[model samples]
Target: MALDSNENSDKSIHKFESMLKTDDVYFFDAEDFEDIIHHYLNNGKVSLGKKAIQFGLQQHPHSVELKLLHVEVLVFEDKFEEAGKWLDELQNIDSHNEEIYVQRANIQSKLDNHKKAVELLQQALELTDDSFDIHSLLGMEYLFMDDYEKAKLSFMRCVEFDDRDYASLYNVVYCFEFMEDYDGAIRYLNDYLERNPYCEVAWHQLGKMYFSKQMYQEALAAFDFAIISDDSFLGAYFEKGKVLEKLGKYREAIDCYETTIEIDDPTSHAFLRIGKCHEELGNDDLAKYYFYNTVHEDPLLDKGWLAITEFYFRKKQYKKALHYINKAINIDGENARYWKKCAEIYSALKNFDEADFAYKQTVDLGNFELDTWKNWVTVLQKTADFNTAEQVLLQAIEFYPEEAILYYQLTLVYLASDKPHEARKKLKSSMELNAEMVTHFKTDLMKYNRFSWITAIFADDKKASA
Candidate 1:
């Protein structure tokens, strides 16, 4: 039976508000003042927090905790000098107090002296018998410095003192991720589970680490334990479903996803995944229904619109694909992938001008791949925009100098513009990069007389062998 601190805090707030309404002399202990002020601060009502501290100080003038909180309020208001003065006075009153050291460390952190803050917190850790908060603060300072290994050790110390410190535990896992030591994370979580086997969150985190490493079976087992520890944990179900999907267990994955929807409200992600699973299982109608449900659940989810668009495109419903992609673009016009998709759909429908515009937008948004540049150049050639195609190839060669295919394609553009010297130069560079792609180049371009330069290279290769 833990204390219902929230209920107590609510009552305290109500009584304080009533006292304010009636102008009555309300009495509250230092702890009550702390809670009331903390409630306001946590809710972003900093003004109200300051008022609480001011009013509480009127009654308990000698309350050191209230004075410390007053310093915090001053700090929050960006009154750093006042906060420092108050901290100095408080240290004189209680030189050995951990809270004073913590406050000073916070001020140092705000001043961008994280190294100084770490030293201050380390001193505080020595002064305190229960150093959970000190360890947590030190870990945050180390994290700010990008010393992930030290940050992880500090958070591990915090978790050792208090296994219920879920935030510190999560930070420990985050530090592991920052270090890219997934094996270390798995070992740490396994050790933590040995101590507190019923901690569902730790199990869930373990599952996530395994999933990242692509150990799908191990991830599935971890998620199963998470669900067993807390049957109502929707995250475990969702994660397990993802692992099942990776394992190609589509029916099992669908069941897990369905269970998540049953235990919690429907999510756009869940609905979309369900649709994908149904599609894999060869149930197009059910897949369509779930895809529709996905957008209905969250109209603003770009993924849902993208999924619906892909579904229509696969079915060769070009008009419907175009409609859905337009809807997606309208929602997130800056999304490069959406523009790229739109370009592909338009190209399939032979809407050359629209496809060219979409491909241009894709490039402008920095969402283009090598294929996008190739497609754009192809469209330009189809529309007899040879000058623009040459310009595009010139720019593309600068970005993709290592790609033999780009140089090969550039040779064609230069030959078309009657720059035979430049064409031969580009052809020589292309052969040097990848002589194997000569077959592909020949198959695509051998019809034109300009392609004679490419054949001359092959002739030279054969002569060298002879």
Candidate 2:
């Protein structure tokens, strides 16, 4: 009868430890040494693994497996040149060994030679009946090459061989997601579930796939199954909460989020979700409490900070909003959204100079949204920085060459700068692009309406159109 692997490993490990304490020699066969070394390496006890390898080779110097284990340890320690030399020596002794090819592939992969690694793995696959590990390695190589289709196939083969291979299953889903093959992913997961029905990880993954497709009910059912399989699965509860929120079940969503907190530590993300749910339910006090909890739990969470800033902004609490937004900016100064928010809050308080600086920061950080440019220009005009306003509008026009509003705004800036020629030129361009938008700035244009040149241009355009 075959020895139980756990029992055998336990006896070998105990014997090895006992021998280490004394100066006595232990008689461990090549396989026992392999398991012992594997145990140390897998558990991240590298020094002990090296010791075990040295002792193992001393006992069985000609054992190819022991030599390979030494090579593995060398690779782990990043002694690539040494490992390669050792592998070459082993290959000469046992060229038919699949492990030689696999270890060579590992070295190639570490060096980022993914294509060469794939070739080596293919050779290993040819030599070995157990292709599961080789397929997993092949999938990773294909992923490194960004060949999602091949990666998906490789990982799927791993899943077929062992349905419990959640890591390979995750890679399969990731490939499908990268390719945006949601239906195919759903189909594959559904088939996987039929064989391994109670796999919480697979069910969690299925829920996310369905959620991506906006199939909320299907997502909810999958998440519920995940929770039923493993009630301690925090991810399922969090996702279930999100699904409930999408379905407008605020109370139920809160319950799910609270369940995650019960299962594990309260995450900033969970607190944020609960806050959003309370906000949806019109429980403003409860929302504010959770929003505070979110930032307190994780001060670095930008989303949590933004939520609090927006909450106060909605209540017209401009000072409070400004305070929280400034805090967010202090945490992530490069965040364009936070800078934009700061600019808007400053503009609301009529702090035009501060607002202008914030707006500049927002643009500098690469936020080229139309409203950002428009709002920044408006702030410049408010501060009577006609020179800078004209410059700002001109820059905005480049990004929005066809946008009539920018041309109209530029016309105003030019008129304010006492450059009627430039103003008329931009006014005509604006009319040409969108004459109807002229109504939006009619009140401002009325100030310059008394100018004969402006009146004449409008008259000529109207006559030409008629």
Candidate 3:
């Protein structure tokens, strides 16, 4: 309908221009001026609109519609004060006019006084015989205020007047999602589907709500319905693929994702998911192919790089994994997980210095995973960097105070450094935290020939308790 309207507007504009060119005086009525002015305004030709308004008033001096268009032009030009004065005059001239109230509300909305805008629009709603535009404006004002429920109601009212208001239908769904009312969204969308069974967006949104609740079969069916409504619905295909993957149907999921690529241009998300589905199906070569395609499609897609890196890691190809992970870090240097992966690969290759640096980057980037810290300490110990190991464990203990493992590692570091006093103190702390963890210290204590220290500490604790 919008396209048809635009086409008619273009034809009218061309006819009017032709008349002006052929005749010395191209006489037109107020309605002709309104159409020309509206065309120029909608097309963002403000100067043309202004010229039409001037010509319009000369032909029909008492045209309230022409006057309203002039005020709208003023508002569009950010001449809010001038527009307000015009609106006041219009209101006085026709006290029962709804357009005047609507224009006033638009100015108030622009001024960031949404409450005033809503009040004025509500007044217009009461006066106007047709409340469609009023309800739409009220919905927008409520949306600006983040009162999504009221906005939803207003938009629903607009929808009631015209079920073809696709924008309002979308907003109603958005409000339901924002409120986390999944059941409400399902009920609303079901009702919407009953009225407009061919609405692809409504079916897609219904599928999403079902997917969120882990109703995989229902989600799949909804997505199928959406695709039936619109065979070229790319989002429905993508979401349906996710549901298939969730249901452990990797091959079917890949087919759906591939269909999205065929329907539209390749998206990074679709490629990544296809790669993951292939990986799950144990088709490593295909997985690697899709993973490479994923990064090739979107160079900045961090997950694509991570997927390729994990592929190599799973295949025991540590060098390739390290290479891809380094590429990931270079692309997104602030990502802690990439740094942690780099640390892990370096540690696997026994490159302790590089491992230490990568671990430092991981911690600095706030990864703080127990494995990152534990392996960092292990690398330090492997490299005989006892002092740094002790320092790292101390920091780890602050974050993992309840974890007996960090304290146990600290105790071993102290003993390795010949700090018997610190060792005994740490060993006592670890035992208090978890007696089961004391077993880990036994093997290391025997290696250091400090079994007597462990026995003595326990005996001392027993004597104190007695």
Error of 3 at 315 (Å): 4.1
Candidate achieving higher TM-score, 1 or 2 = 1
Q: Give the per-residue lDDT of model 2 (tens digit) for 1-466.
A: 0112455687899899999999999899999988888888877788888888899999999999889889887776778899999999998998999989988898899999999999999999999898888898899999999999999999999988998889999999999999999999999999989989999999999999999999999999999999999999999999999999999999999999999999889999999999999998999999999999999999989889999999999998999999999999898999999999999999989999999999999999999999999999999999999888888888888898999999999999999888999888889999999988987887788788878866765576679889
| Superior candidate under lDDT, 1 versus 2 | 2
Kindly give the number of clashing pairs for every candidate: 0, 0, 0
Return the clash pairs for model 3, or none. Answer: none
**RMSD to native, candidate 1:** 3.4
The lowest-lDDT stretch of 10 consecutive residues in candidate 1 is: 1-10
Candidate 2 backbone clash number: 0
Best by TM-score: 1
lDDT digits (tens) for residues 215-317 of candidate 1: 9989999999999999999999999999999898999999999999999899999999999999999899999999999999998888898899999999999
What candidate 3 gets wrong by more than 4 Å, as runs, is: 1-7, 16-25, 40-62, 73-77, 313-319, 325-466
lDDT to native, each model: 0.88, 0.91, 0.87
The residue-level lDDT of candidate 3 at 357 comes to 97
Ranking by lDDT: 2, 1, 3
Candidate 2 has what TM-score?
A: 0.86
What does each candidate score in C-alpha RMSD?
3.4, 3.9, 5.8
